[model samples]
Target: MSPNRATTIAIGVGAVLLTSVAGYAVWFDYRRQTDKDFRRKIRKQNKKVSKVVEAENSAKGARTQQDLISAIIEISQEPTPTTPEESEKYFMENVAIGEKLSTLGPDAYVHAATSFYRALRIYPAPAELMQIYEKTVLPPVFAIVKELIGIANVIAQQSSRPAEAGIDGGEGEEDEEAMIAALQAAVAGAGRE
Candidate 1:
């Protein structure tokens, strides 16, 4: 075929494709503007997808909460450092590990928090160390550590109460029970948010 003839055929094909595309666009726009059933179907589909996404997120959230609770419980159950030298060394190791893990990102937050909780247990003064953590630690990790401390306190109180009751002839039992109740409330409140 001649060059002019080929060029004419190409332009004709191009024009046909463009016209078809523009015609489809106009039809789509008109359907969207005037078709109530079509619009409602789209909305329903979107709502369905949104509900599924919400369900999945809620499932993930439930798992995360359970994991946090289990981690706190496990850390509370672990044996503690017995001697001053052992306590200091354990504290330093855990603090260093926690600090390093905290930098690795969100997926490592639980491990980091557990490490910090371990160090806090052996620290010479936990309240002061916590103040330092507040300044230096990531917020999520800090929150986890805080929850662990509360739950550990509850566990510690429960264990000691039995022994102390035996020793004190049951004196101050009410105060002990009240303190346990208060710590439980704090732990529950912290987990809510």
Candidate 2:
């Protein structure tokens, strides 16, 4: 065979091998990227499913507002006092009801708010008591009330929508904001009195 022909054949073989290797690398990279994306999507879906299951489990054991109120009333059976010192003591004893209700999550906010309001009703109107009320009791009550308002707004929006459009239509952002503003105003008014 001629040297020139042998050299040409060698060049052709080298080119074919290089092209095959490049093609295989590109295909492998594409497959790897696709697999990574699929795994990420599956992880996200699993997280969503787990959250739904957790909510369901929690709801199974959740207590109603009436149940909470009844429990509070049962625990707080002390007679109403006429003296300021006794009233302060009574308020201090029942303050834990608000804290407990606050821990019950947003579903129990109405009950929590009611408990706080009741505590305030019997509280002595002295200046020192007012400071304690504002500093200690008001924040958790306000927070629970705010959460209740938000939940109510969400429910109202969901109920008002057409069933075909799905439960949470994502159109209640504005309504939620307006409701929050209203709740803040109402809470502030209640706090002043």
Candidate 3:
């Protein structure tokens, strides 16, 4: 090849190499930023869930008569769920607590449920705790008990679907259900025992 042609080809190759390196740097920077953002989001979610778990745990330890009574009074005196919407709100919150309590050890479940039952005694009216007991407490407890259950039903019906699905089924499924059932049955059977 001619000298001029060789120099032009070399210059073209150099430009392509420079462009490739620049593209890679941009991609690496974007990947790093994305990872950092993802980690930050996870940390935030963990903090929120952890706070709720901690509150449930603290509630578990308050077993004394006065302590239990105080919580009951607080729940009872709180404005009764005046509307269906408000009742639903309370019920959903209870569901979350129930799901968490179901995963705690036997003692934790006993304490949590005992606290729940005592709180119910204070606010047994259909207004708050009773409604929640029926709505939130029972269903998740049942779900916690029955792992063979489905999520949206359709997803479960998909013949090719996985053996496990969603939050209800995964690595934590067995342990979570066992813990929840043990706590529930223990607290439930306490009066009989």
Candidate 4:
């Protein structure tokens, strides 16, 4: 095109880029100045680490006890959706809530675990979901979730076996007991760490 037209286009593009950069700088500066939690944000440039991270580690350290049993029980008591579509939606929401709560601190672990457990209950393939949890969930939270699953399995075994039909369920009970014991040991070891 003409020289003047090319110059005008280049100037327009440069002005647009410059304005966008200035807008971002103002936003970043305002947040850095006014947002209290901004200082604790985890970034390459962030110097101060948040207490939430410390609290999460401490929470993992303090998971030696059986307090999570009550949280699991409470989660089980909460109403769950019956339909498949509703269950899917519920599962997504709980997982999101669990992830959000996980970043908060130690105090939120129980609530986070509760949310995860709720989602786990409605999942189509619980074992698969649990495997995913083992990889992605916090160690302490995963331990609690494993314990919850162990308890659920034991309960399922008990109900299906019944008091009189104890013949077929013996192996299941043995396996469940072993799993529960292993989970308990793992949790205790995590606390020692």
Best by TM-score: 1
Off by over 4 Å in 2: 1-33, 36-48, 51-61, 64-67, 72-78, 83-85, 92-118, 124-134, 137-193
Supply the global lDDT for candidate 1: 0.78
Sorted on lDDT, best first, the list reads 1, 4, 2, 3
- Write down the TM-score of every candidate: 0.60, 0.32, 0.28, 0.46
lDDT of each: 0.78, 0.57, 0.49, 0.71
**lDDT winner among the candidates?**
1
lDDT by residue (tens digit), candidate 3, 34-119: 79876787679999999999998776543332233333334434665767777666655654665577567553443355445433
Report, for all candidates in order, the number of backbone clashes.
Answer: 0, 0, 0, 0
Poorest lDDT segment (10 consecutive residues) of candidate 4: 161-170
Q: Write the per-residue lDDT of candidate 4 for residues 74-108, one digit (tens) a residue.
A: 56557879898999999999999999998898778
Root mean square deviation (Cα) for candidate 4 = 14.6
Q: In candidate 1, what are the lDDT values of residues 1-193, reduced to their tens digit?
A: 9999999999999999999999999998899899999899889999999999999999976566556555665666688889989898999999999999999998888889989988987788889999999999999999988867766665555457645323232336575445444444555665475
lDDT accuracy of residue 107 in candidate 2: 67
Superposing every Cα of model 3 onto the true structure, what RMSD results?
19.8
